[model samples]
Target: MVATADLYDERGEELASLPLQLRDLGGVAEFSGPVRTIRCFEDNALVKAVCATPGAGAVLVVDGGGSLRSALMGDLIAASAVENGWAGAIIHGAIRDSIAIGGLGLGVKALGTNPRKSAKAGAGVVDEPVEIGGVVFRPGATVWADRDGVLVER
Candidate 1:
């Protein structure tokens, strides 16, 4: 992929940027694809379910309400996504198993890392628009992430 800086110069106003201070936690440095949104709070059942399916080169955007109490994703779920051919995962909340995920060869970005796992109450809404840190991640939105940052295009 080209540098986001160049994409900015080339596409100009065609791209919309996501404003967040996310950190990379995956082995891959860059990834892009249409979005599949998940809205949840301190729960990862829906995240697990969505990622287990074949992504077909799609990005999973999980809105955990920026919760730092528990991790919305971990090595197990991340590995499942990769095995199912997911392109990447973007979490609006914390995640665990940073070291394990970094070696999975998957693209993952999250606000931070936590040691605690989330609840399994089968909570959260899937394929819904999620707003995180003042940024809206809607379904079907294109997501591009590189060393520069993560940007969205409608």
Candidate 2:
């Protein structure tokens, strides 16, 4: 994968800078692919539903409203992402079971970890445009993420 810094250097100000304190929660530190967006606050039913489908090397970008109160993802959902062929997951909310998640091959970046689980109400919007850290994530855009940061190419 190309380094995000290099990509930034090449694109310069044209590239949208994704400023977030997302930690590398999964085993892989860097990952990139076409984005698939999900807008959900604290419910994870929509997230689980997406993880169940074939990812086709795409990245699941979840706009959880940066909620640290509850974990939008956990070990099982992350495992599903790996099994379903997702390149990575970027969550604006929280996740749980960091140790277990780090064991998986999937690339996961999130704000932080929480012990509480999310509501399973199946309430959320899929494939919607989500803005995070001054960056807008739209479905079908190629997103490059690495140790430096995340970038979006429309």
Candidate 3:
């Protein structure tokens, strides 16, 4: 994958740079694919369900409302994502099992870590446009991420 910095330079005006300083928590340092979004707060039922389905190299973009109180994803769910062929995930909230997730092949970027798991009330919308850091991650738009930052191809 191309570095985010180079993509920005080559097509700065055509991309929307995600403004979050997310950390790379998974084994892969970079990943990119068409967007698949979920909007939730302190809940990950939808996240888990979506990851269980075939990803076909799409990136799951979770708008978790920036909640650090609980984790939206953990090792098990991440493993499911990898098995289902997801390219990566960008979580706008917390995740658990960082060390274990780091050993998996999927790329995971998130705000931070927490040991507490989120509620499973299925309180979220899937495949909808999710906005984070003033950028809208619409389904079908390509997203690229690396150590530098995230960029949405427009």
**Candidate 3 residue spans exceeding 4 A from truth:** none
Question: What is the full ranking by TM-score, best candidate first?
Answer: 3, 2, 1
On the 0 to 100 scale, the lDDT of residue 29 in model 1 is 88
- Name the candidate that leads on lDDT: 3
Cα misplacement distance, residue 15 of candidate 1 (Å): 1.7
Against the hidden reference, what TM-scores do the models get? 0.95, 0.97, 0.98
Which ranges of candidate 1 are over 4 A from the true structure? none
What order do candidates take by lDDT, descending?
A: 3, 2, 1
Lowest lDDT block of 10, candidate 3: 145-154
Better of 1 and 2 by lDDT: 2
**Relative to the unseen true structure, what is the C-alpha lDDT of residue 87 in candidate 3, on a scale of 0 to 100?**
94
Count of steric clashes across candidates, in order: 0, 0, 0
Residue-level lDDT tens digits of model 1 in 55-77: 99999999888888999999999
User: What is the Cα-based lDDT of residue 51 in candidate 1?
Assistant: 90
**Cα lDDT of all candidates, in order?**
0.88, 0.92, 0.95
Q: Per-residue alpha-carbon lDDT of model 2 for 52-148, expressed as tens digits?
A: 8999999999999999999988999999999999999999999999999999998999999998988999988999899998799999998988878
Candidate 2 residue-wise lDDT at 135: 91
